[model samples]
Structures are given as structure tokens and as C-alpha cells.
Target: MFKNIISKQLYLLSYLIRWTLISIPVSVAIGSMVALFLWLLNWAIHFRFAHTWLLYLLPVAGVIIHLLYKLYGQSAERGNNLIIDEIHQPGAGVPKRMAPLILVTTVITHLFGGSAGREGTAVQIGGSIANLFGSWFKLNEADKKIILTAGVAAGFGAVFGTPLTGTIFALEVIAIGRIQYNALLPCLIAGLVGDVTVSAWGVHHTLYHIDVTDVSGQFYGKHLPVSFLLLAKVLIASALFGLTSMAFAKAVHQVKSIALKVIRINWLIPVCGGIIIILLTFLLGKPDYLGLGVDAGYPNAITIVSSFHQGGADFFSWLWKLIYTSVTLGTGFKGGEVTPLFYIGSTLGNTLAGILNAPVSLFAALGFIAVFAGATNTPLACTLMGIELFGGEYALFFAVACFTAYFFSGEGGIYAAQRVAAAKTDDNYLKKIFSKYRP
Candidate 1:
């Protein structure tokens, strides 16, 4: 019995050490690559600001991007979906070329004034880098998937400086209503290490805030964190957030479908997309709805940071961003969707706060995570993001808003490859409950 116990402990110890070995190197490499990509992305955006004429060259840039993809990027074109597909079924193990290809294309998308997000780019970078390391280690089918998830966690954590949220998002985003515990250890370690590595590279993440005082004094009491009425408002508003997310997801898919049908010539889609974007920019008379929607350099820019203040964003800020991003990405522009979703959510939240008579910053923070939660179908991760980016003081509200948004978001999400383990929409449950009474 003593010998058996000793052997069991040894096996457990070996398991821990083995994963640590695989996960650390993968995380470090992914983190470094993400840092480099972020640096390049910043340079591209700043350079575009310096040269406004670059905006006019957007259609040409699209042509070049389409040609590049047609020539050597078909395999990597699926982007984040490709990574998820590989994880679900270990085929070739996420292509090593995906990292550089997406990195370059995403940079180009931003450099030429495309309105897109960075999360997808970071995630693709993470998955590809991690899978490559998995190959080097000669990991088995099971281990390869874990490493892939770890890569995603590392990329996400490093990109956003939210290790815990990254880990949970990587795990949760793979399947709706299902969290894979198989990658728990590897993902956790990779996320922490990845976040630390990016910080070591002197990359600074954007900061957000949420003050309790943003809400009315009537909602606060000595015993309760927030009044039930405020919670109700969040519930109602979160439903809209979920609907907005659904609309955005559907809009992207619809735009792509229509563009495909309307434009028989494959390469012309992006060129036309670029023209529409340019026209929109001229119509708006500013480039506010371009890039990541987090332009820190533009002091008066409408961004995630500005949405917390009253009148910081215009009434239609969310709608404009949705249109801009949908057109940009739908027509073959590279870049992720999460940051723009943040912009939309925060702005929408800002608008709703005014109407609801709630605290502007608090609702903005709620929108920040809630809409992402809805769009990604990862409420738990977005809730953690709220806690990480804003503050833990509103953790309860974050969970409430995110979970509500998730239920209302419908089955659609940003990642097409994500599996549907279960869906909890009220229509099905309500129909079931009232079916017996329908007679």
C-alpha cells in the first residue's frame, strides 16, 4: 500500500512537471510574438494618422491584400476558425504559417484604415505558435489540443493583460455552455506567463474604470451593493446588448454573403469595401470609426475610454461602428472583432445610461464586457474581464449583465467554428413550459 501510494504521487508529480514544461515555452513564444505584433500594429496606426492620404490608398491596399491571400493565404484565411477547427479535430495541427500571415494582413488592415479588432489576431497568433511548439515536442493528439488552448490563452492574456479572463475565455469560447477542464492547468499557466511576458516587453494595455457613484444614490444602501431597480435596468439593458450582439454577428455574416453574391469577381469585394469606407469617412468628416476604435492619440476620439463619460459618444456611435466594422471585415479585411464590439457596447451603454438615468461610467463598463460576452458567447470570461479591467467592486453586476446578455444573444456569435454545447434561450424553455397549456 505504501509503495502504491508512492508510485501514485510520483505519477501525479510527473504530470504536473510535464505540462509545465510544454506550457511555459509555448506561452513565452506566443507572448513574445503577440508583443511584436502589438508593437507593429501601433506603429501602423500611428503612421496612418501621420499620413491621412493612406486612407485614400485603402482600396489599393485591399487589392494587394486580396492578391496576397489568393496567392498564398487560402489555408490561413479561415483565421481563428481554422485554429478552433484544428483543436476540435487534430488534422495538420494549426499551420505554423498562420501566425506571420495573419500578423501581416491584420497590420495591413489597420495600416490602411480598416476598422477592426485585435483579439482575433492575438488568438490566431497564439494558436499557431502553440501548435508549432506542440509539433516540436511531438505531443500526441490529446496533448496537441491542450497546447492549442494554452496558446489561445497566452495570446489573449498577453494581448489584453488579463490572464484570468484570457484563460477562461480560451476555455469557454470553444463551446457554448461548456467549459473544458482538460486544459485547465496548461491554460492557466500559459495565460499568466503570457501576460507577464508582454508586460516585460513594456507593452501597456488600456485602462478603464467604473465608480459606484455613477449610479443614482437611490440605488445604494448600507446593506446592498446596488438597488434591485438598478439591477432590473441592467437586466433590461443587457437584453438589448444581447440583441445588438446578435445583430452585429448577423450583419457581418450577411454582408459577407451579399458581397459574395453581388460581386462575382472575388478580388473586387474588398476594393469596393474600401471605397464605401472612404465614402463613409468623408461623409462623417472624420476617421472616428476607423481602426480599433481605441485611438488614444486622438484626444477627442470616440473610443471605449471615452464612452464612460456623459456625451462622450454620439447617439448613433454604436450603429456607425457596427456598419464600419461589418463593411471592413465582411469584404475580406483582416483583424479581429472584439475591440470594435467593446466600442459598440460601451457607446450603447453610454446611450442607455442617459435614458435609464443610471450611472454613465458604470453602465459603460457593464456594456464593455456584456456585449463582448454576448457576441463571443463567453459570459463567464467577459465577467472576469470586467473584474480585471474595471474593478471587482461591481463583480456581481458584471456577472448579471454578462449572463443576461449571453442568454439574449441568440445562438450566433463572432466565431463561426465555436460549437454549440447547449443554448438557453427563453423561447425554447417558455414554449416547453406552456406547451401543456396550449390546448
Candidate 2:
């Protein structure tokens, strides 16, 4: 009996080891290609001549956005939502054309100065690549799911250079209260490979820059008690950030709902949305809120946190981001809203930090993950992301804040097609609520 058990364990272990060796490099390669395209696209928008043609761009851009949506929106409807759908229904894979549609639309959005994120574009491209592999391998339903998960990890890891977080994101995103342990090895390998590949390819990924030279180990040793208080504040502030994120999501849904009701033609949705965005930019008298807003982080334009001081950049800039993102996404303009969520969280957290005299980097990191947790309903992924992007020094604080944000944000998710794969965190409440209002 003992020999039989040992033999079985050895077989399983060997199988996993072999699989990890093969999958990681392949997945990472796919992810790297996706990242290269995304980086090139973003660079073109930010540095190429496109940025110089602001005066005559709006109306022409509006026409292009209108035509793209009218012709391709329905088939492309399932980009983010489709990924969520596949998590609930295991055998599913995103359509082949979804990647091209998203890539084209996203490039158009950036070219025209639409406020959005790049992850969506990268993920779709990766998914499209993985989908081809799945077909070639003739993978079973379970294997297909593994491929999908690896693709997500690879894509995210390539962009963020945080393999652990990307791996966790792949496991956490599919289910509300469950993860597939069997899928971990492939996801981890893919994430690591993707990160290494992107780094090799000269992409400038996002990372937090903090100046901690002033604080010493003695300070940490003597002020160990202060860590708890800082964490406590982080927890409370993160919850507020989560709530605000929920509010932003609700606002988008409500606005989209109203727009659909008023404008029956599908093309008009993007047209009207583009017009609103253009009008807002003109009224604001600048283009600071446009695109990914990474330019906000360039040089010393005041971090989102410093905007909170009286007559500082915080209040209006944050509000403008909120309005611009809400309108741009809510109006059927095709793009990813995840990066905007980051901007929102960081700005809100920074504003709060300025008020409380807390460490702005600490609060900014917390807000970045907390809002992501609330928006995606993936607490573990959010926590991992904070550690990966900022560093593990505040891992405990990130975990606490992320879980709090996840709990307070409730059952709603950013992706409408995301089904409840498992029971909610609060089973009884979820059951009751689900019974009353079926998603």
C-alpha cells in the first residue's frame, strides 16, 4: 500500500515537472509578441506624429470610431466579458477575430486620444495566440482552460514584470471562491517567461519608484508599532477607495444604460461618446486627462497624491479622470477601463494621504490594488499585483486592503458576462441576493 501511494505521488510530481518545463517558455513567447505590439502602438501614439495633429483630429476620429463600432461591435462585444464567460463555462475560447477588433479599436482610441488602458489589448492578443495553440494541440476542455489561464498570466506578466501576481491573477479571476491547484504550474511558468521576454525586448514596464533613503532599519525596528497604525489607516482608506470604485462602475453602467435607451443606432453610441469626450477636453482646455494618463507620471507633474492640497492638482484632476473615463467607456467607445481604475485609485489614495500625512507611496499602492480588487472582484490577484508592482515590503498591508476591498465591493464585477463560477465569499447573503436578483 505504501509503495502504491508513493508511486502515484511520484508520477503526479513528474508529470507536473515536465509540463512546467515545456509550457513556460512557449507561453512567455506568445506573451512577448503581444507586449511588443502593444508597446509599439503606445509609443506611436505618445511619441509619433499622431500627437501633433490635435486640431483637426476630433471629427475625423469620431467618424472612424462610429464606423468601427457599427460594423464590428457585436462580434467584438465579448473581449473582456468573454474572458469572464469562459471562466464560468470551461470549454469556452474567445473568438479568433476578437483580438484584431480590440487591437484596431484600441489603437484608434489612443490615436484619437481616448482615455483607456493597454492591458486589454495585450490580453486579447495573447488569448488569440493561445487560441491557435489550443486548436493545433486539439486540447481537451480541461487542457483548453489551462491554455487560456497561461495566456492571461503570460500577457499580464509581460506588461507588469510580476510573475507571481500574474500567476495568481490567472487562478483567481475565473472563480469567485475557488482556484484550480492543478493549473498553478503552467500559470507560474508562463508568467515568469513572459516577464523575462518583455524585459529582453526593451519594453519600459510600470514600476513604483520610492525614496526610502531617509528611513533606516533602526527606524523600522524602533517604530515597529507604527506599522500597525499605518496598516490600519491603509485598511480604512482602501475600503473607501473600493467604495468609490464601485460608484464609478455603477456610474458607467447607468450611463451606458441611458445611452442605449436614448440612441437606438449602435454607431451613434461611439459617435456621441467621442463627441462628449472632445467637448469635455475643450472645456477643460487641455488634453491631460486623455489616453492612459501615464504622462501624469512623467517628470514632476505632481503625483496624484499631491493634488489633494488646497489649490493643488489633486481635486480637479482626479474628478476629470473620473468623468472622462466614465463617459469614454460608458458611451460604447471600445477600450479597456482597468488602467483608468488605477489612475482613479491612485489619485483618490493620494488625496487621502495628503489629508492624513501618511506615506503617499504606501497609500498609492494600496489604492491601486484595492480599486482593482473591487473592480475585478479578484482579491488575491490584486494583493499579488501590489506586491509585484511596488515590492513585498507592504505585502501584509496589500493583502489586508485587497481582501477588505473585495468584501465591501459586493458581487458586481466590471465584466457583465462574468458569471458566478462559485459561491460568493458570504454564501448565505449571496444566495439570498442572487435569488432576489439573478445576474
Candidate 3:
């Protein structure tokens, strides 16, 4: 028994030391690349703002993007899905070119005013880098998955400056209703190290705050300081947030299918998409929905941060962002859906708060993470994200909103490669209930 105990302790210590050493360099590589991408992305977005004529060249940009993929993209065109598929099955290695292909295409997408996010690009970079390193190290298949998870954790954490959320997200995003805890230590080490590496490079992430507190003057039970009525409001709003996520996912998927079918010429799909985006800009008489809503060229623009205040967003801001992002991404634009989801959620939360008579900032904060949680099926990570970005004052409310949104959001998500480890709701449960005795 003592010998067994000694052997176990030795094994555990070796495991810790091994992963720690491995995670640091992986984190540093991923973090450095992500920092570079963010810098280039910033310059691209600002340059487009300086010269709005680039918007007119969007069709040309789209053609270039399609051609780049057609000529050299190959498996790299799969983007994040390819990485996820590689994680699930370890053959057909992630190409070294994936890093540059996604990095360049994503910048081009944003530079030309295509509405998309950077998270997917960062993640692909991380995965590709990890895959490359895995090859050099000649690690076994199982070890490769662990290192890849760490890479994902590093990329997400470094990009957002939220290490804990990154760790959880890396674990939870692989499959719904399940998490790969075996990778926990490596992911945590990578996430923390990666975030530090980015900050070390002087890259700053967006700041968000929750300006209102909903603690009632009267306390409930022995320790509950929040009002039950406010919780009730959150429940209602979270359900709506879930439905909105479903709508966004379904809209993007259907639009992509329809556009691909209708435009048999292939590359013309994005061309038509670019033309439609131009028409929409004229139709709306504003360019507010053309890029990542984090920053706008025009004054008084509604953004994720702006939605935290009352009257900051139009009643239809959420809908417009959804439509804009759906069209941009569904028609072959290369970027992530997360930031647009953030814009949609916060704006929608702003509208709902007004109708619910709740605190605008609080609801917006909840919506920001809750909608992402619903869409990505990563409630725990989003709950931590709320704490990281805002504060822990509303942790309970954050969990409530995120988990409720998760259940209601269904199993479909932005990543088609994601598998359902467990169904959210067994569709045949009712049938089983009715025929239980017969069976």
C-alpha cells in the first residue's frame, strides 16, 4: 500500500512538471501570434475607417478571398471546424499554412467592412501552432489533444484577458453536456501564461463594467441579498436571449445554405453578399452595422459598451446586427461569430431592460455573456466571463442567466463540427413516457 502511494505521488508530480514546462512555451507562442494578429486587426479596422471607399471595394475583396481559398486554402478553408475535427480525430494533420491563411483572410474581411469577429481566427492560429509543435515533439495522439486544448486556452485567454474563462471554454466547447477535465491543468497553465504574454506585449482588451447593483434593501433567507423579483426578470430575459441565439444560428446557417444553392457560380455568392451589404448600408442610411461593433467611425454609434446605458441603442439595434452579421458570415466572410453575438445580446438586453424596468447595465452584462453561452454551449465559462469582465457582485445572476440560456438555446451552434455528447432535451421523451408500459 505504501509503495503504491509513493508511486502515485511520483506519477502525479511528474505529470504536473511535464505539463507545466510544455504549457509555458506553447502559451508564449500562441500569445505572441495572437498579439500580432490583434495589432494588425486594429490597423486594418482603423484604416478602413479613414478610407470608407474600401467599402465599395468589398466585392473585389470578396473575390480575392474566394480565390485565395479556391487556389490554396484546401483544408485550411474549414477554419475552426477543421481544428475541432482534428482534436476529435488526430489524423490529416492541421497544415502549417492554416495560421497565415486564416490570419490574412480575417484581416481582409474586416479591412473591407465585413461584419465578423476575431476569436475564430485566434483559435485557428492557436490550433495550427499547437499542431505544428505536436509534430516537432512527436507526441502521441492523446498527448496531442491535451496540448491542443492548452493552445486553445492560451489563445482565448490571451485575446480576451480572461484566463479562467479561457480554460473553461477550452474544456466545455468540445462537446455539449460534457467537459474534458483531463486537460484542466495544462489548460489553466496555458491560459494564465498566454494572458500574461499578451499583456506583456502591451495589447489591451476592451473594458466593460456593470454600473448597477440589484441587491434589495431587504435580504432573503440567511444570505441571499438579491431581490427575487429581479431574479424573475433575469429568468424571463435569459429565455428570450436563448431564443435570440437560436434565431441567429439558424439564420446564419440557412442563409449560407440558400446563398450557396442560389449562386451556383460559387465565388459570386460573396460578391452578391457584398453588393447586398452596400445596398443595406444605403437602405439604412448609416454604416453602423458594417464592421465589428466594438468601434464605429461615426459619432453616437451603438456598441457593446454603449448598450450598457439606457437609450444607448435603438430598439432594433439587436435585430440589425443579427441580420448584418448573418449576411456577412453566411456568404463566405472569414471571421468568428462571437463579437457580433456580443453586440446582439447587449443591444437586445438594453431593450429588454427598458421593458422590464431593470437596471440597464446589469441586464446588458448578463446578455453579453448569456447569449454567448447559449450560442457556444459554454455556460460555466461565460458565467466566469461575467465575473472577469464585470465583477463578482452579480455572480449568482450570471450563472442563472447563462445556464437558463444554455438549456433553452437547443443543441445547434455556430460550429457545425461540434458534436452533441448529450442531447439538451430528448425529443422523444414524451413518446417514451406514453409508451413506457408497452415497452
1-439: candidate 1 lDDT, tens digit per residue: 9999999999989989999988998898999999999999999999988888899888888888898888878678899998888888988667778899889999999998999999999999999898888888989999989999999999999999999999999999999878999899999999999999999999889888775563333523455546778889999899999999999999999999999999999999999999999999999987899898887546788888899998889999999999999999999999999999999999999999999998899899888899999999999999999999987888888999999999889997989999988766557778899998987
| Superposed Cα RMSD, model 1 | 2.0
For model 3, where is the 10-residue window of minimal lDDT? 214-223
- Go through the candidates in order and give each one's C-alpha lDDT: 0.90, 0.71, 0.90
lDDT of 3: 0.90
Off by over 4 Å in 2: 48-52, 55-59, 62-66, 69-74, 90-92, 213-223, 296-313, 421-439
Model 3, span 93-158: residue lDDT tens: 788888888889889999999999988988888898888888888899999998888888998898
Question: lDDT by residue for model 2 over 176-228, one digit each (tens)?
Answer: 77787788988888888887888777777655643341222235457442355
| Model 2 poorest ten-residue lDDT run | 209-218
Span of ten consecutive residues with least summed lDDT in model 1: 214-223
When 1 and 3 are scored with lDDT, the better candidate is 1
- In lDDT terms, how accurate is model 1? 0.90
Q: Which regions of candidate 1 are displaced past 4 Å?
A: 1-5, 212-223, 425-429, 434-439
Q: Each model's RMSD to truth, in Å?
A: 2.0, 4.6, 2.2
